[model samples]
Target: MSTFFSDWYYLSIRSIKQIWRPLLALIPSLFIPIFFFVVNSSSLDAFSKVPGFPPSITYRDFIAPTALFTAVFFSSGNAGIELVQDISNGYFKKLLIMPISRLTIILGRLTEVAVQAVMQGTIVVVLLLLVGVRIQTGVLGLLAIFAMLMIFAMAWSCVSMISALRTQNARLVQSLFVVVFPFLYLTTSQAPMPLLPPTFRLIASYNPVTYIIEGVRALVLTGWGNPAIWQGFLVATTLFVIMVTLTLGSFKKALR
Candidate 1:
């Protein structure tokens, strides 16, 4: 049991260090969403005056959570990219042969992803604050939002983890980057669900990403009393469980 944790610690540190070494790898994922946030919020600040939009909030406040969502969600696949590198360079097989639990290896990468979420999420939050966005729930809600985002980051990264394990093809795994577009745009990134066109409204209603966005967005625009936050927690938790299970299965298969 202690050994599992010990393995997780070292492996996680290694993964985190690699991200910071180049640093450039993390920049695009972090900044692109900020640029999007700046442009959209500036252009759509007038949209807040429209009917059916939530009251007492500007467009910047409403879309702040969505920007955070995009930043973290878009970066989730990076762990898989690292895993692919380990495979290509023969380091992964070395770890496989070591005297350690296989599950620990996977857990280590997930931990790294969680740390990445923290770093990226914090940057987004600080940027939001600088832009005059405030969290309605105060410090507690702010912390809770970070917790939920980490779960979300880990859950989404399992896609890349599974891809790296199953295909071992870097290009194929990189191609999965396209998946972020549908999940991001299909949600309430631009406008509230009620304000969306009928087709977009129906689709956003079904996308779990919508709840996750609303959940975090509520922390900024509303408060803890809003049920959207809990729904986000639920959906993100469910996704983490399902994706981690599948990832473990893939890990076991790769060992075979």
Candidate 2:
């Protein structure tokens, strides 16, 4: 047990060092969402309070999860860059040649990325709180938001790493964000799916991101419960399994 943990610890530290640049690149990522929170939120609050909708919802509460999801979406998608670098620079090859367990290398890299995602999510949440986004569930609710983001990050990171290994094309992986973000925002994050048009509602209903947003929204918005929260988690777990299996298979192939 100790040996296994020791291996994980070593690989985890190495991953943190290796991906320091990408992690540090989160500066703009940290603030851009806050900018949106300030701007659109001001407009949204005023408009939502009109006679029909009375969008009394605060700007901070409404947009906070979206920012958190954006962080997860972009971070997970871009995680491939680190893997691409590792492969191109031959660091991945050297790691593979070591006596370490293959799974440890993969999990350690994933753990490191997950840690980074949680940190980014926490910062965004704090920013939201500072801006007066009240969490009805208090600290526990806040933790739930972080937990959901972490799960999404973990599952998506697995897929991102697999894509990194298979394609080894940083551009292709980077393009994933453009695809993912639109799908994510089109869901319940920006607005409730029920209010969307028929086709969009259908799409949002089945969208995994919708589930994630709903899960976070449930905790954030209060009284917004849905069974799909659990469903979203199941879907994420299934995706994690498929991605990890593919990644491990590919790792063996690459080593051969």
Each model's total of backbone clashes? 0, 2
Best by lDDT: 1
Off by over 4 Å in 2: 22-24, 50-56, 223-229
Clashes of 2: 2
113-208 per-residue lDDT for model 2 (tens digits): 777787777777777778777777678777777777777777777776777787888887666766676677669776655567798888888777
Residue-level lDDT for 148 in candidate 1: 86
TM-score of 2: 0.87
Which candidate comes out best when scored by TM-score? 1
Query: Residue pairs in steric clash, candidate 1?
Result: none
In TM-score terms, candidate 1 sits at: 0.96
Q: What tens-digit string does per-residue lDDT give for candidate 1 at 80-131? A: 8889999989999999899998778887888888888888888998988887
